[model samples]
Target: MATTLLLAGLMLAQSAPAITVEAQPGLDQVGYQALSAGRPDLAIERISADPVMSASDPAALINLGTAYARTGDRTAALARYKAALTSRDRYDLELADGRWLDSRAAARLAILMLERGKALALR
Candidate 1:
């Protein structure tokens, strides 16, 4: 019985998703500071370094895209935002139709699209 319980516990633990430290607030602050300080490059780098802000994170991807756009990297910015959208779709985790896996994803995508000179036509 003890061995069965231990094995079950171990299996449960192994199945849990890894926790990632998000840099949302800090990245937001850094973004504003960099923008105000006329340093979009720094903002881009700071936000892009976050593990949670990679292509998989819609919110992070949007922020990264915005940063790229601010730095005049329109192509890269678009790519990131599109990648975010694609990721959101592939997960099929309830983000379809812009519901968003995380609440921030949709909002960030909207903002980033606007920044990227694309008008959001949310249905």
Candidate 2:
């Protein structure tokens, strides 16, 4: 978990705004569409329900993190980010502004980490 968080932190070190989630077609696309529609719960359900997505889609993983963070469950959000880092592909996320609960997903997580000043995931 620490390794995943560390990698995400390192990737985020670039400081770019990741507002648009790079979504693939199928369940992943559905998930992104759901989130864009302001139905994070449905987004989560759609993405998490797909077995292939849980294993392969980095975008879906990031979207899941966004959903969790949006719903105010930082723990869940951190877990989703950790899972995203496990993907062999290094996906660069340039999120769209205000398209998510916060302006940027990773930025929001960073801010939440700062405000809370804790979380093993943030370490």
Candidate 3:
């Protein structure tokens, strides 16, 4: 009976849908691509050069936080994530796997993952 239950759980986990979170268009998108390419340094450079990226939008902040987290800068990452959480901007963030999330919801999720030492895997 235990073996059967284990197999059933494994099958359920495997059948679970994948979630993909896309970056905001433009610079945020570029930064996200850089991060995905494993170049967190490049992501930081691109996203940090302009304040406009973070000004009314949390997308860049979220990306920046992820990049910082990738680079092992937990403090900076948390700061960015926190800032993103407070941003007034609202938009639907579409994931690569076709799921949509509110930008703030994405930010909150990112924060939880970072706090738990998980790498931010959003697109």
Model 3 C-alpha lDDT versus the unseen true structure: 0.59
Q: Which stretches of candidate 1 lie over 4 Å from their true place?
A: 1-38, 88-123
Off by over 4 Å in 3: 1-30
Q: On a 0 to 100 scale, what is the lDDT of residue 42 in model 2?
A: 81
CA-lDDT, candidates in order: 0.42, 0.47, 0.59
RMSD of each: 15.1, 10.2, 11.6
In angstroms, how far off is 48's CA in candidate 3? 0.7
User: Order the candidates by TM-score, highest first — what do you get?
Assistant: 3, 2, 1
Which candidate would rank higher by TM-score, 1 or 3? Answer: 3
Candidate 1, residues 1-123, lDDT tens digits: the string is 010000000001221211111233343422434533445477567666666646465544554565566556677767766766766433212222323234244434445545646422111
Q: Best candidate, TM-score-wise?
A: 3
Candidate 3, residues 1-123, lDDT tens digits: the string is 010000000011221211222343343442665765567798789778777764444667776887777778889988888887888766666554456666777778778877777544344
Per residue, candidate 2 scores C-alpha lDDT tens digits across 2-69 of 11211122122122222225343333452655655555688779778877765555555666766666
Clash totals in order: 0, 7, 1
* Candidate 3 residue 23 C-alpha distance from true site, Å: 5.9
Model 1: weakest 10-residue lDDT segment is 1-10
TM-score of each: 0.47, 0.54, 0.71
